[model samples]
Target chain A: MLVYLIRRIGQSIMVVAVMATLVFLAVFAVGDPVAILASPDADQRELEAITTRLGLDRPIYEQFGIFVWNALQGDLGRSFVYAQPAVDVILQRFPATMELALAALILSILLGVPLGVIAGLKPESLLGRSIMTTSIFGFSLPNFWLGLMLILLFAVQLRWLPASGRGETVEVFGVHLSLFTWDGLRHLFLPALTLSLYKASLVIRIAQAGTREVMLQDYVRFARAKGLSYNRIVFVHVLKNMMIPVVTVLGLELGSMIAFAVVTETVFAYPGMGKLLIDSINRLDRPVIVAYLMLTVVIFVIINLVVDLLYAAIDPRVRLTESKG
Target chain B: MSKAVLDVKDLSVSFRTREGLVTAVNSISFSVGAGEVLGLVGESGSGKSVTGLAVLGLIDPPGEIDPRSSIKINERELIGLPEEKLRRVRGKDVAMIFQDPMTTLNPVLRIDTQMIEAIRAHEKISEKAARERARQALEKVGIPSADERLKAYPGQFSGGMRQRVAIATALLNRPTVLVADEPTTALDVTIQAQILSEVQQLCSETGTALVWITHDLSVVAGLADRVAVMYAGRIVEEGPVSAVLEAPIHPYAAGLIGSVPSRNKRGVPLAQIRGMTPSLTNLPPGCPFAPRCDYATDICRSTMPEPTPYEGGRAARCHHPLSAPTPAAA
Candidate 1:
């Protein structure tokens, strides 16, 4: 297990390096951030000063080397727009996005797993078919549109909840959280709901598939024959087996959830890393943009590594095979 | 004589398919007394395994047990029993050991968890007590170092050992009836013989009725006190093992015995039953085996024959049974 962890960490490092290099080159290849940062009427000399100040005048290779070195030192360069270190700016907004993602993930598991199991257990039943039909909307409807529809119905028409923004905040353990405040929870609901719908659908499909497949396995039949109560058979036998694949999907989805939150955050005007990313992109904040992309990539790689470890934990067969390697 | 532990009467199992209603098992009746081993012998698709599942009330939707059918364990009706009551009876009253031991035990769970869970399902025993029983059960099945083996997962065990664990689980609660659905089919001959004897001895000691479902006549010849030969979805012949193996009355049963390699001359091609199994969805009005029976007559094709007593408590579902001068006791 120690060797496996060490090997996975090594692979993760290589993956992160490749991603950083690619993003560095891609950001540079795009239209210059200098134009967006500089005044339209700035003279050549003024522009040159700004360009050199930002290290734009340096060769691409040298710029990339400096970027890699700074990244290794835990410094993503200063944001052109915010005039602050990109890492600090992202960190300040990370909590909001994390909160939203976590809530959405919790909601997805709470609603999707049970519903998926029902659908799988009785695939031809009326309730199962209806759950499946509704989930298709979750998969197909765009998050932005879903967000808008929710805002229109709940905020504009019904006025049951706030339309946009993270509401009032409370300090707990030296951290300001919106989840505790009533107004903040009300504000958090719409965006989180819209965000979770799509993910919940994905969970439903995965869970249903996993449950159905495991239900046919010999062990399940044996469990039933052993006279296990329906509850025990479903919960202990079927659920444990089904969770292996579901956990893999959820781990991978978490990274994408952060990535996809950009549109959702923008739609609801939620103060999160995704919204910050959008603003940074518009203002030509190259450091912030590069940092965001690299962070997401690293997160994805780490999540996959964790997922591999979880597979071994969940299944002895996998553990045996992994040990042999 | 010991009381009958399982009494299945006119039991039929059918599945609702997109094409039509497919009868997997037609009206079949048999009983296994306590300490008795009844071998349900049939080829693939012969509904032998379905009968075992139906007895356990394990058939799910798309597959339905006929309402009129009756399956009683220790005189308690199993068919149409409520799920809650059936659950109480399951594992406690009757348990099943399935085919493919490699897959029958949950791959993720330790042997102790699976075995103890089976015990605890029927008995409200302490975990420690359950574990003790599980260890004893494993030891009874010839597993060495039973205490250590209990901690290992099913994937860590070999095929034969896994089957032993499965057997241990079934016997954990000392169920009144134990249905083994070809548990050794995936094992080697030596392992198969070992398991067969061990299971037979265990059942006799515990007085648990044992139904060994298999397609191998030779397996039945050795392990079973009585044998019932199934063709398609019906039992074509049933008698004491010695009688059935020595002289089968039904043509299909005779053909099955003949198809066994040991029955033929060493140099000759083995005898075989002619024709494929009739499709359950579109079976003829008469006997399902009539189309394949060499002695099939017009009467055989016109009407299905009910099981009839021949001699020595033997029965066969046929118009004309093979004549044997000697009569044997059950």
Candidate 2:
């Protein structure tokens, strides 16, 4: 297991390095930060001064070398707008995105698994048909559109929830968190719901398909023949076996969830890393953009590693490799 | 033989398929007494396994058990019983072990969990008591290191060991009837004999009515007290294992026993039953086995033969029952 972990960590380092190089080249290849940061009325000499001050005058390779050197030494440069370390600026906003992703994942599992199992258990039933139909809609609808629709329905007309922004954060062990307070959850709901609908649909499809297939396995029939109650057979036997595929797919989905919370965050104007990323892009905040991209890459790597470990844990056949078949 | 512990009468299992109503198990009547093993012998598609499933009330739709059929355990009717009551009857009164032990036991769950569930599903006993019974059951099946083995998963066990675990679980509740459908078919030859003996010993000791379903006549020859031979969906012949093996009245049964490698002359070609089982969706007018029977005549094609009893307390479903004289009881 330790060897496996070490190998995974080594792979993650390679992934991070590749991502850093791509993010650096891609950011530099796009619109020049000088044009966006400098005033249009500025004289040529003044523009030159600004360019040199931001180190734009340096050669591309030289600039990349300097960036790499500082990045390796635990400095991701400083954000132009926040006037803080780019890593720190992004980290400050990380919590909001983390909370949103966690909430979305929880909602997806809680709602998707049971509903999916129901659909799988009785595909011909009216309720099962309706659940599957609704899941299709959830899967097809765009995250931004769903976010806007949720806002219009709940916030605009009903006036039940705050339309935008994180509400009333309370300190929890020296970390700011809005999820604990009722007002905060009210704020978190629309955005989290928007983020989760597609994911929930994915879960539903996986669980439903998985449950349907697992239901036909001989063990399931054996379990039934053992006089296990309907609930026990479905929940214990079917659910455990079905969860294998679900976990693999969902683990991969989670990385994309945290990375792509961008669209939902933008639609709801939720203050998170995605919203911060959008603002940094608009202002041509090169350092913040680079740092955010790099962090995202590292996070994806970590998630993949954790998923492999989790797979081994859930499936005994995987963990006990030396055992006879 | 002891008094009947399980009696199945006119049990017919059908599947509604695109082709039409396909009868997998035609009206079949048989009984097993406590401490007795009845080997149900047949070909791949011959309804023997279906009969085993019907005995456990497990014919899931698209498959259905005909309402006209009856399955009784201790004289308690099982056909048309509510799912709730049927479930209670299963695993408790009648447990089943399947063909592929690799698939019979849930791979992810530990051995103890599966065994304990089998016990607790019927009896409302504490987990501790169930665990103890599970442990003892494992030991009964001759699995060494009972405590450690219980903690291990199915994949950890070999194919033969896995089948033993399945047998142990089936016997956990000391069910009155145990339906084992080709449970040893997937095993090695030596493993097959060992498990065959272990199961036979356990059933006789517990007085559990055992229905051993298999296409292997040699297996039945050694293990079963009585044997029923099915062709297509009907029991073509049934009698004491020795009598049927020595002199089968039904031509199909005769062909089956004759095809056994050991029974055939060493230099001659092996005898065989020609023609595949007729599709249940479109059976021939007369006996389902007529197309394959060498003795099939106009009467055999025009009408089916009802099961007829002969000397030696044996029966065969054949208009032209073989004239092989009954041998003296061994």
Clashes of 2: 0
Per-residue lDDT for B1-330 in model 1, tens only? 367889999999999999899989999999999999999999899999999999989898889999999999989898888899988887888999988988999988888888888888888899999999999899999999999999999888999999999888988888999999999999999999999999999999999999999999889988899999998899999989998888889888889888989734888998998899888888888888889988889999999998787677688888878865343443
Candidate 2 local lDDT, A218-319, one digit each (tens)? 999899889899999988899998999888888888888887788888988888999899999999999999999988888888888888889888888877
DockQ of 1: 0.80
List residue ranges in candidate 1 displaced over 4 A: A171-174, B324-330
The per-residue C-alpha lDDT of model 1 at residue A294 equals 87
Q: Name the weakest run of 10 consecutive residues (lDDT summed) in model 1 chain B.
A: B321-330
Per-residue lDDT for B1-330 in model 2, tens only?
Answer: 678889989998999999989999889999899989999999988998889888888888899999999889999999878889999998999999999999999988999889898888888899999999999989999999999999999988999999999999988888999999999999999999999999999998988989999999999999999999998899999999998898788889888888888733878888887878787889989988888889899999989999877767688888887876543353
Docking class of 1: high
Which residue pairs in candidate 1 collide?
A: none
What lDDT is reached at residue A301 by model 2?
87
| lDDT, residue A126, candidate 2 | 98
Worst 10 residues of 2 chain A by lDDT: A316-325
DockQ winner:
2
